[model samples]
Target: MDLDVAQVRAFVRTAEELHFGRAAGTLAISQQALSKRIARLEALLGTPLLLRGGTGVRLTEAGRRFLGPARRTVAAADAAVAAVSGADRPLHVDTWGHLYAPMRTLARVAGRAGELVSGHGRDLPSVAKALLNGDVDAAFGRVHPPLPAGLAHRLIRLEPVDAVLSADHPLAAEPALRPDRLSGGVLWAPGPLDRLDFLHRFAVRFGVRHTATSVNLGLGHFLAEVAREPDRFSLMPADVPLPRVPGLRSVPLTDPTPLYAWSLLWRSGDEHPGLKGLVTACAEEGGRSRWLEYDPARDWLPEPPASGPEPV
Candidate 1:
């Protein structure tokens, strides 16, 4: 039997997300249209692919089995189209935090004329939204999962997270500190990271109180806050050069430090002619960098319990 590719896509996405609203948002379609497409697909198969009781949706046994073949079909279709057309569009790339050097390399690979919009998200999810909403073509950030159905990701680099404290603090003298040592102390962080469930759970497990601030403090103010408060701390990238602040100190976090596994994310099958080259640029830039390493084993963050779908 022939199947409509668009209807199949709608069913697959809705099945993955289990929420019509989110799936529709990802596909840039109305929820009603998405539901209708799924209903049509179900009619064609003469079986309910999803179990929509009351609270939300869950896949039927058929859906669980059909998902694999459905994905393969979609992938093959996209590949065929890409091979035939070989069309390319101008790409937009963006990121959060200080990922400038490697992103500059990406811009060069995208083409000197390609647009690179920086600071797209305060955190990863916002960046994912920008991609879904067509605000940007590509973005760089952490790869938290239950990601949308049609997004592609490449692990670019592992950025080491370290501790920032007052120079006069007792722990500052240590070459490296462990999470247990941070117990009972407060870690002041930018709002985004603190709001993440993984970080929150990890902090609680380690007995540290992670406090997020709404204000984006300047470097001077950041240092002042660390130095002025005895019980306060912050996190930073260990390999990145630190400013010489007399009262502030940066120390390595040893014994399983958290590494921000930076990745490049874009919608799969979109295949801008320059996207492949831009990814190559990120890989080569990651290769030459002394600070960023490609270690998948050490690049993971703690996973929190799944409540709903996570993006990026």
Candidate 2:
């Protein structure tokens, strides 16, 4: 029997929620209807997909194995529909809010009709999902390793990350702070979850014992937290200016300063002539723009220690 999209969608939603009632609510159907859909899916597959229990439901081995492909199948179908329906629409470009200067420059060079969608204070996973699902035509953000297999990417610029500290702190008097000085300090702005391995490697390389903590706050509040706490510090791109607080200062992290490389990513095999023009514009404008001023002394930092955190 052929697989049915509706049944597959119901199964996927049920698998995600792990609750028939909630999944049905999400799908705007009654629990009974949701159960029937999942039953039909199981019948078509000729195997038990989910195990029903008192604590709700759990995906059986077969269900676990099929989850990835099911999601991809749905995404592919959605992307095809979007491509045909939006053929005449302008390109949608996503990037960090602070990086708009360079992205705007790219748009001008491309000379194509498009809009910039800023990912302000958003993490990499969400951005990647948007690209994969065709929510956006192109995007710019920090380099995420093991980029999705079907996407193409190019390095745009290398922006150095600087240390933010309370101006009155003892180390604040130094012209440049050493990486080792960060030991036992708390990082107010936690790095992305996808970079857990990288963060571990960084800590080992610098011989620093730092704890990263996340705070959900706007720029004003974030700066206030840094200014109020003597030991609390943050790492931010030197190219982007932070809210100026009376007791806060942005200083270069020395003895080894880390650089965050920004990249432009798009779906591979996408043959939109306009996209090609956009890519050309990005390279051309990126070449002439001084989005980042690289200091030779800080151009390259020491790599993480050979023996570091294991991949997650």
Candidate 3:
């Protein structure tokens, strides 16, 4: 027999309310429409489900038997919806290359095994929202306070930022970059949701001029745009390499600060066994991750271990 979901819903609601008029009101349909729906459901099932009696409605033996399967069908449908809604969009990792080093590595490993769909974002809120809404498989995000429930994360990189410039820019020839000299330029700011806004805040925190006009979430796009420009630049860690855009140079910042700490963010405790391996890969990559490195002795750190020092 052909089964329609709407018919199933109507049937369930009628069973719930027991009063046809109240059920109709609950479903926002006319009592007559509700009655017709019940008629259709009964006709399809080839059974008399309801008996009009004294002051209330009663379900026939067939109705009682069908209730279990009907509820199960609705539950199955809901589960299907949740899965589809969660899987329809590509999983968004809400951090730049520097922040999501471990997640990227794990994703690559998983990809080889044909087990994951991976992508990235450039900011925290976007990652958080996507994870909360089930749009991403995983992301690298900051350890923000009051984190939403059901997400698991581990530190992957703890690095200081440096100034990045075009080869032709004046600072490109400097011995080392400093925050004081990092301001007053068009910057490549990446945000998961609002790239420009996040950059402005970042600029303010570092006392750099936050007057950037162009920002983007896509690193590839940022590199392309910057390569074509003359005075545009932003502060990045020396270890976080950029795409080999011709004429682009990233220099070490002299008075570097702990500006970026990267982590892998995802729905925690998934039953998938592959996720455990992915999590292990991320935790092991911490501080020593290939994506960025840290030399603490020389005060040059990117994905460097917090305890060790490396000479510049």
Candidate 4:
């Protein structure tokens, strides 16, 4: 029986994510389409591959047995396509956490990294799924654990964070403010606190009790909102260029500054030539700019950086 590559691919992605919505997102297809593909693949094999329960999807014995070979098949198909299309295709890189302006860091290395095609992911999970699906060659973002298997990351930068508030706010005139100084004020965030791992961790750690959120329309809009409320404040990477939002003041956070970690994520065992160039360039730029310097006594990270040796 001739196996459809698309169906096999659907199964592989679904098996990796175990969530149809995310898997469908990685495939850039609708959930219905993903379901149809999985169903057809199961029918062709004449066996159930996945068990769907109230909790979530899980691999049946057949699926567990087929997963390894299915992954190989998908890789082979991708290899075949790359072979004919010329391997010099521009490396596609996805970025998330736009509030931090991750591209600013990427730009420092872009000149040395060669041809690149940039895309934006909604968040780290979506970017991770895209990396797993081979939809993008690499991604940049603030990666938090537990990172999914089959991926690798290298810490590229640790940016000091600043507390942004209205110039009219009482604390705005301070050159540097301790994190606790903002405890009584509302911590403004871009979305639901639970969904924003970094900000949520910061709030919980710093004793910021009251919290508020706004749609992440962009840096300008978000900062403008913060500028409007004297008692509202938000965190931003110190290096992000501030927009001309009136009444905006960015004060450095001192006495254990919160550092925003940035990392480069790619599929483990990827042999793309451009991937090597990008990694090397990041290392060079990071070293030159002192991007990875950290002092536990004076700096704070939500979690330790994932800068361990590359996984095999």
| Candidate 1 local lDDT, 1-312, one digit each (tens) | 899999988887787678999999988999999999999999999999999878799999999988767765665566567557845544567776642233433443454334444555766667765654445667776677767655778776666677788877778888988767987667765455544544565577577865655355655566577777767787765555566777787788766677655668886655555566667666566667742543445443554223422233
Per-residue CA lDDT of candidate 4, range 119-168, in tens?
99999998997887888889999999878766789888999999999988
Ranking by TM-score: 4, 2, 1, 3
Supply the global lDDT for candidate 2: 0.64
Ranking by lDDT: 4, 1, 2, 3
Cα-based RMSD of candidate 4: 3.6
| TM-score per model over all chains | 0.64, 0.70, 0.52, 0.85
Most accurate candidate by TM-score: 4
State the C-alpha lDDT per candidate.
Answer: 0.67, 0.64, 0.58, 0.90
Candidate 2: stretches off by over 4 Å = 25-28, 89-113, 116-157, 190-201, 210-214, 263-285, 290-312
lDDT of 2 by residue, 88-108 (tens): 556676765342233444544
Judged by whole-model lDDT over C-alpha atoms, candidate 3 comes out at 0.58
Q: How far is each candidate from the true structure, as Cα RMSD in Å?
A: 6.6, 6.0, 13.0, 3.6
Off by over 4 Å in 3: 1-104, 107-114, 120-123, 133-137, 142-146, 184-198, 215-221, 227-230, 237-241, 257-259, 287-312
- The worst-scoring run of ten residues by lDDT in candidate 2 lies at 303-312
